[model samples]
Structure formats: structure tokens, C-alpha cells
Target: MVIDLPFIWAALIAIAVLAYVLLDGFDLGVGILFLGYESGHQRDIAMNSVAPVWDGNETWLILGGGGLFAVFPLAYAVVMPALYAPIIAMLLALVFRGVAFEYRWRTERGRFLWDWSFALGSTVAAFAQGVALGALVQGIPVENRAYAGGWWDWLTPFSVLTGVALVVGYSLLGATWLVLKTEGKIQQQARDYAVRAGVAMLVLIGVVSLATPYLNPVYLERWFAWPTAIFSIIVPALVLGCAYLLFSGLNRGYDLQPFLASLGIFLLCYIGIGISFYPYMVPPSLTIWQAAAPDDSLAFLLVGALILLPLIIAYTGYAYWVFRGKVRPGEGYH
Candidate 1:
């Protein structure tokens, strides 16, 4: 049935989003943290840590988008048009980031320029994703399976808050990554940042959780349903415990714990959002079945995914394995 297809599509989309958050999230965090501290050596270490895997992380974002377009053309028709401007802005930010990483060391004067590019790009990209996500949550102006409102409709206050929240969340992920990958001073500072970021995330998520029901009563009823509430509480509690372990591990100078904790947090958060949306791909607007491609199209896409998805997964795994271990200085990301 079409219902099964949406669930399948939703699962795929969630994986892509999770992949982006995990892979690109750390690099973006490092970029923001780079601005806070004045240590060139630390910056090099941070950049080196993500260089090998950052590009691959972005692949999933593309895959997610492409797959959505391919498998759910109806969904794309509505969401993409509604989100035209922000999506364009997000792409520009990503382009800036890709180029900046390459040109960062082209010349001495290029240092500040590239640094700003990387930092600003990361900040903007994170914000753009959050805004798009927020707008989806807040409901789109869709009528008869088409986007109704103009471009600026995404610029709501709730969307802005989601943008800021995602930045803070990425910073937490970056700090935890540093805690796992670095040693001595950088690791220690990263630990401090992780703790701070974790605390802030808790507060922000709390506020968001409280506000969501008020923002949309439908979401409130969906989330507040008895069995669903239990699962939601359990998963997030586990995430909180993971955060505690990260702090404890950092306190004890446990190298691997921080990154593991970050991963757990991201996973839990992804799951929570998945639950929040339930049947809707674009909330308050289109249910996933309402937004799917035809059965024949999904079948064709499935054939391609059978080949392509595994290749992507295998290559991604291999790349991480090759880049395993700590990053070293004087080694350009190239």
C-alpha cells in the first residue's frame, strides 16, 4: 500500500538527516568554536579531524533530497516551492563552505577570508536547515498539493528559534568530537564546551517541547498520546544519560565517551523528531502517502537504491575506516 511506501521513505529521509547531523555537524561545530578561541594550532587540529569525512557526510544530505524528489514527487512539489529561498540560501552556504575548505591555505592573507567563509557557511547552513525544518513543522501554505505562500513565509519566529537551536546543537556535537579526537589542552577545552553546550541543549529542547503543543494542538495530541509519550520519555531520558556519561567520561579523561555520547544524543533527537511527525512528511499539510510518487516510480527507484545505497554505505564506511585515529598538524586536509 501507499502507506507502507511513506514509512519507508520517511525512514530513508531520517537516515539522511541523521547522517548529515553526525558527519557535517562536527565540522560545523569546530568552525563556530574556532571563532571563540584564538589558537591557530587548535583550528588546524579541528579542521583536520573532519576533513577526511566531511564531504562524505554531505553526500547523505544530497541523497536524502534526491531520494525525496525521486520517490515522493508530490511531496517535493509542495515543500520545495514553499522553501525555495531558504533552500537556495542553504546551497550557497554549502558552496561557500566547500570552496573555503579548499582555499583556506592558498595564501597567508587567505587565512582570515577562508576562516570566515567556513565559519559563516557552517553557521548559515545549520540555520538554513533548521529554518526549513521549522517551517515544515509549523505547517506549509499548501493547497491542492501545491505551495500557496510566497518565499518569505518560512521566516517565522519559530523558525528562527529552530535555527539558533540547531547551531547550539551542532556546537555540542563538535565539542564532543574534539573531546574524542584531541589530547591535552584542546580536548580539555572541548570537554568544557561539550558540558556547556549539553546544558544549553537541555534547556532549549525543554522549551521547544513545552512550546510545540501550544504552537499546534494537533502535534500536542499526537505526542501526548499515552503509549507514544512513554516511548518518547524513555528515549530522551536515555539521551540525557548519554550526556551525563559524556561529562563523566570527560571528567575522567575518557577519550571515546564524548563522541559516543554525541552520537547517542543525535540519534535520540532524530528519533524524537521522527515520532513527533508520525504520519506527516510535511506536518499539518501533507501526509507521507499524500505526497508519494506513483507505485511504478517507487518501484523503479527501489531498483536503483538496491544498487546505489549499498555503494554509498560501503564507501562511507571505508572512508571512515581509512581516516580512523587522530588528526595531525601540518597535514593539509587535502
Candidate 2:
């Protein structure tokens, strides 16, 4: 059988990106919520909650980015130049955040600086990611197989809204994470934050959803067309169901359920995006096969990815297992 290498690579890359968003996302969320915690001890506990696995969570990001460069060179060429600013900002923010993780522990006098560094870095990175997503979804102009838009074409109102929406969404994830990982006053505060962020996230989801179909006629047809229009009903229904579980879990003081439900909502949103961009790698311009590298390279990489991906999963799972349980005052992973 002839292997559909491009499709397989696309799926792998997509999974890798999702794993990065869900994994690194919460830690970044924790960082986003860092400033709101007035008590230094509470902040310490929050940082401890993620420190053991936070850095490791970025492996999937590396895999996703490298896979894109290798497997879809054409898409990469067009996308990178178009999104150079936001992508550069995201990378710099991530670097600054990583430095703060280590340096904050080393100096008492300078800790405040590091704390702000962490929070700002997380916020900027999340915002930039959302902006890039918005820009992509709205469509990148391509002419003669190259980016045709001006340098600042990415900075639209819709992209800014998406950026703000991501900040709110990540804050929700961070708050729910604290609910899962801490106890006592911190948990209570996290619950409060989660409630506010959750409501905001749902509203933004609705706003973005309403606005998305209007961005491209294809999206309009994919989402609101007769046969596929059932998704418009079904996806919202699923989101509402997940929102119910999230709020109910918080109300009932259940730890894990709220976090899981939050993840479910994100997963469903991701699926919605995939539905909109099924055949396109660079939407409205390039399809997966058209943008892919030679088949032989993809097949070779597939062998390596199949082996590497499982090991990464196993390692991540084991780390979480070993570190399972609540983070307490005066104790930490970092």
C-alpha cells in the first residue's frame, strides 16, 4: 500500500501542537495568575505545583515546530515571514520566563523582578500565540507561492481580541490547576478566580465563534452550510456540557473534575478549528499535500517519530505520576 505520508505527518504535527498547548498552557497560565496572588507563600506553592514538569512540557512544542519545518517546508516558508514579529516575541518571552524560573529562587532582593518577568512573559507569549492563530485563521495572503501581505498585516482588531481571549482562557486554566494542586486558602482563591475566568472564557468563545465564520466564506460554509450545519448546534452543545461539568465540579469542591472538564473544553475547541481547516495547511492557499516535503523524507521521519513520540509520552506520564499529590506550604519541587 502507498503510504499517505503527508497526511500522517500532518496528523502527527497537529497532535504535537495540541499536546504543547494543553501541557505548557497550564504552566503559562499559572505564571499569568502569579501576580494576582498577594501572599508570597501562595505563589511559592503555585510555582511548586508545576515546576517538576513545566520545562518537560515544552518537548512537544519542539517536536511540533521541528516537524513543521521538516514535513511542511513550503508552509513554514510562507508562515514564518508573515508571523515573524509575534513568533519572535513568543520565543523571547518564553526565554525570559524560563530564566525567571531559576533566578527567582537564587536572590531574595531581586525576586520581585523575576516574578514580574515570569508573569509578563507568560502573558505576552500567550497573547502572541493567540494573535498568530487569529491571523492564520483569518487567512494569510499568498501570491506566487510567497507571502504577499505587508509586515503589519497581522495586527488586526480580531487578532487582538483573540490575544485577550487567550489570556483570559489561560488564566482560567491556571486557576483550575491551582484548584487541583493546592489546598486551604490558595485553593479557595483559585476557585474564585476560576469562576470569573471561566465565565469570561465562555463569553469569548461565543464571540470568537460568532466572528469566525465571517472571516472566510469557506469557514462560513463549513460551519453553517446545510449538512455540516449540525456541527454549529452539536459543538455548542458539547461546550455547554463541558462548561456545566466545570462549574459543577467547582461548586461541589471536586478537585480533578474541574481541570479535566476545562481540558475537554479546549480539546473540543481545537476540534472545531480542525473542522474549519481540514484540507489546508496554510488556509485558502496551500493544502497539506501541496505543502509537504518529499514522500521518502516523511516516511523516514515517521519511523523516528513513532518511536520518539511514545517515549516522550511515557516520560511525561511517569513524571506526573511520581509528582502526584497536593503541594503544601514550606515544600516544593523547585
Candidate 3:
């Protein structure tokens, strides 16, 4: 069956966003867990847990951006222009984290610098992305698909809230990941953080879910309407179940279960967002209908995805298989 261009972009962006979340999710999570470590040794362990596959996972981000640029060139034109400054900042942070990853273990003097840089870079990048997301959600000053605003235009209460939320979200992901990767003191610290972060995240999601709907009546009507209310109950129920498993797994020393549970929470949140903005890729400024590529573009890209997606899945699975094990002392980060 053939679909419209808007549907194609919607589907592709959803895939891109999911790839970014899962691929970079655990790495950003590592930085979050870095703060939970007692020493550089534990830090190294946490870092190494993700090092083997983290960079490979980044191909999805590149692909996501590239796919968007290709399929929804219009969105690229609109969003990048409105978001030039923050996007640049986000790229810079990504650069610093990449640099710090390589430089951290060369010497003692450089150790502290690189360690702080990694954490700072990760934190800033997460916050910046969140702000950009929030700005997009809250809408930018645009006329004729071009930004018509000053430097401070993107700075708003909603955008600031998004920055904080993304930090918390990343920290939650990191804590869960540590629970999966390490053991003993590091494991316990990670477990503790996961439980706390889980609870905090649960509350934050609830508040945001409620508030975001009110942010736009279009959203409000969609969420609060009849029958769709069924999903409302189901989504929260699933999230709560995951939260329950997270704490239960943490308390029982169940190792990887907490991580799996946290992932469930993140995935559920992803679903909620997808549902909330079903037809709108660029809220208040553009609809997915307005921003999609042509039919020929979708067909070409979709064909490539069918071939490449499976290979990506296989490689990611194998890499995880190869790297699976408790990180040992003196093993060091690559």
C-alpha cells in the first residue's frame, strides 16, 4: 500500500528519534552514571561498558539527521535556521565529549580535565537538545518558513524546563545502565540512583504530560477526548509497571532487570510523544503534511531502510554480545 509524503516523513522521523534515544541513550546514560562513581577505576568501568559500541551507535544520529535533510528538506530549512545557535552549541558539546573520551586516560593531569569535560559535555549537550526540542514544541518566531526573531527568542520558561528534564532523563538512563553493567559499590550506587531517578522521572512525566496538553488546545482535545482516553490509562499503567520493576529489581539486586525496566519507561515515553504529536513534526509552525518529501523520495529511502536496518540491528546485537560481562578492574576504557 502506498502512503502520502507526510506519513512517510512522520514514520522516518519516528524511526530516527527512536534510534537517537536508544543508541545515544545509554552513552548519555554513562555520563550520568559517571557522577555516581567513587573513583576513576569505577568511572573507567562504566565508560568502558559502553565504549565498544557507543560510536557505532552514532551512525543512527548521522542517518537520522541526513534522512531528515533528505526526506524533509523543508524541515531542515526551517528548524536549522531557527535553531542555528543551539544546534551549533549541541554539536560543540558532542565534539568535546568525543575528545574527552579519547584523552581521559593519557595521564593523571589530563585525567581530571577529560573526566570533567566528558560529564560537562554530555550534560550540556543533553540540555541543549532538550531546549531545542522545547523551543520547537513551544514554537519559534517564523514567517514564510524563515526565523524572524532575535537571540533571546528561543529562551523561554518552557524551553528551560525541557533542558532540566532532559538532564534528569539522561541521568535516569545512566543510572539504569550502571545497574546493568557494574557490581558491588558501583552497582549499588547506580541502583540507588535509578530508584530515585525513576520516582522523580515518573512525577516529572506526569506533570509534563498534564501541562503539555494544556500548552495547546489541539493537544488537549486529542488527549482528553473520548476513547483516546483509553491510551492515557494504558500508557501511564505501563510506565508505572516499569517503575515498579525498576525499584523491585534494584532492591533485590537483580542486575540487568532494572536497566530493562528503565528502558521500558523510556520507550513508553517515546510512544506517548509520538501519539501526542501524531501529524505534527513542527508544532505551531508546520505540520508533517507541509514538511514531508515527495513520494519518490519516501519510496527510495524506505527501500534503503529495509536493507540497512537489519544490518544495523545485527551489528548492534553482536557488539553487545561481544562486550557483555561485568567490567573488570584495570581493563580500562578504549
Candidate 4:
């Protein structure tokens, strides 16, 4: 009996990527929402809300990227050249955001510099991520087992739309997260932002969903064909259900439900993407097996991953549990 090492590694990498998106996503959202706060103190509260777990949340990103490079080098090679611009922008933005996260707290005189840095960095990182995603979804041209596309291949109208969509989506996540983690005027402001962002998110999601199927015949069949078409109905229905929860939670002033529902919407969208890209690590050209490393390497990596993944999860969970509470003015984990 042969173990499907490639499939296992793919699943692990997928899980890591999803964890990064769901966890780091909100902090990025919070940073993106920074400038919207009317007062500097409100910004402080927002930053404090995420300071405890933000750095930790980025661990999954490292794991995901490392797994891709080590376990699926071919996919990494193909994807990197296709997405160099956005990927580089994302990394630089994240670095700026991190530097701002620390430096903003140190000096009162030049703090505004860091404040704008944080906001712009987070926004750019989120946008770059979305553009990279859009570029990937639109498909990279491959020839002779190499990237055959131009340097500007990633920049397109559809990719720009996705970039905008992600910025709005991340803002919604930040707003709802603030609703869950802060109180007083900040919470109220966040609730308002959540409503506006939520509506925009839904509309953008609909537009993206509609446009995505037309990008590839495979996507059209994966989404709209009989048998699999059940997902077409089911995913949207679930999204509607989540939307109801989100709006109702806001209307009723419930704390956690709206945030959870927002997360649900993201999860459903990720699942939808997965359904469309199953069996393929890089769409239009490569399958998981073809992109994967040798079985010996995969097996060795799996042993270490099995040991490390649980530890990371446990640490992340413990941090959140320890820090669970409302972030008031002038109080923070840092």
C-alpha cells in the first residue's frame, strides 16, 4: 500500500494557508481600518486589540510559504515568477506594517508617520494579496514546464477588481472584529463600518463570483454542471445565512456572532475556490502530484509537520484564550 504523500502535503499546505487568511486577515483588516478612526486614541485601542495575537497569527503564513517551497517546489517556481510583483509588494507592505506596529508606540512626536505607514502598509498588503489571487485564478501561462507570461501579466482589470474586493472584505472583518473586541464609541463606530463594509463585501463577492466562472471552462463546469451544481446553490445559501446572522447580530448588538459570521463568509469563499481548483496545485497546468517533492522528502517533512502543527495551534489558541476581553482606551497586550 502506497501512501499518497503529495495529497497529504497539499492538504497540510492548504490548511496552513487557510489558517493564515482567517487569522492574520483580521489584524490586517484592523490596520486597514486605522485611518478611519477619528481619534488617535481610538486607533490605539484598535491596535491594542490585535497586538497580542497579530504576530502569532502570521506564523501560519510562514508555514504555508515554507511548505510550498519545500514540499511543492515546482508550484512555487511557477507561481513566483507569475506573481513576483504582487508577492514582493505584499512582503514589503507587511514589513512596513510590522515596523510601524512597534515604532508607533515609542515616540509621540513622529508617531503620525508610523500611523500612516501602518494603515497604508496593511492596505497595500491586502490589495497585493488579492491581486496575486486574482492573477492565479485567471491562470498563468506555462510552456516547457516554466512560466511563459510577461512581467505585467498579473496586472489586469479583473485582478484590480479582486484587489479592491479584498480591501473591502478585510475592512469588514476588521470592523466586525472591533465589534467583538472593543466597547463604547469604538464598538459603535465599528458596527457602522461593518454594516457599510458588509454590504459592499456582498456586492463585490457577487460580482467576483459571477466573473470567476467565465474565466475558465473548468470553473464553469465545476460550479454550474449537474451533480456539482449542488455546491452552486449550497454555498450561496450558506453565505446568505451568514449574511443574515451578520446583519442580525449587528442589529441586536450581539458581540461575537457578527465576527464569526464574517469569518464564515470567508471560509465559504475559500471552499468555493478549492472546489474549482481541486487536484491541481497550479491551475491550467500542474497537478498536485506533478508539483510535489519526492515521497521520501514528503514523508520526512510530514513527521516534523505532525509534531510542529499541533504545537503552533496550541500556542495560538492559548494566546487568544489568555487575552480574551475588551480592549479599552490606553490598555493593550504590548
* lDDT of all predictions: 0.81, 0.93, 0.79, 0.94
Predicted structure 2, TM vs. truth: 0.99
- The TM-score values for the models, in the order shown, are 0.94, 0.99, 0.94, 0.99
Task: Give lDDT for model 2.
Answer: 0.93
TM-score of 3: 0.94
Q: State in Å the error of residue 7, model 2.
A: 0.8
Candidate 1 all-Cα RMSD: 1.8
Q: Give the per-residue lDDT digits (tens) of candidate 2, residues 26-85.
A: 899999999988747888898899999988999998999999999999999999999999
The predicted structure with the larger TM-score, 1 or 2, is 2
The lDDT leader among the candidates is 4
Worst 10 residues of 1 by lDDT: 1-10
Query: Which residue pairs does candidate 1 place in steric collision?
Result: none
Evaluate residue 276 in candidate 3 and report its C-alpha lDDT on the 0 to 100 scale. 71
Runs in model 4 deviating more than 4 A are: none
Instruction: Give the alpha carbon lDDT tens digit for every residue of 1-334 in model 4.
Output: 9889999999999999999998988999999999989647889999999999999999999999999999999999999999999999999999999999899989889999999999999999999999999999999888888999999999999999999999999998999999999999999999999999999999999999999999999999999999999999999999999999999999999999999999999999999989999988999789999999999999999999999999999999999999998988768844
Candidate ranking under lDDT, highest first, comes to: 4, 2, 1, 3
Clashes of each: 0, 0, 1, 0
Candidate 3 at 6: error in angstroms? 3.9
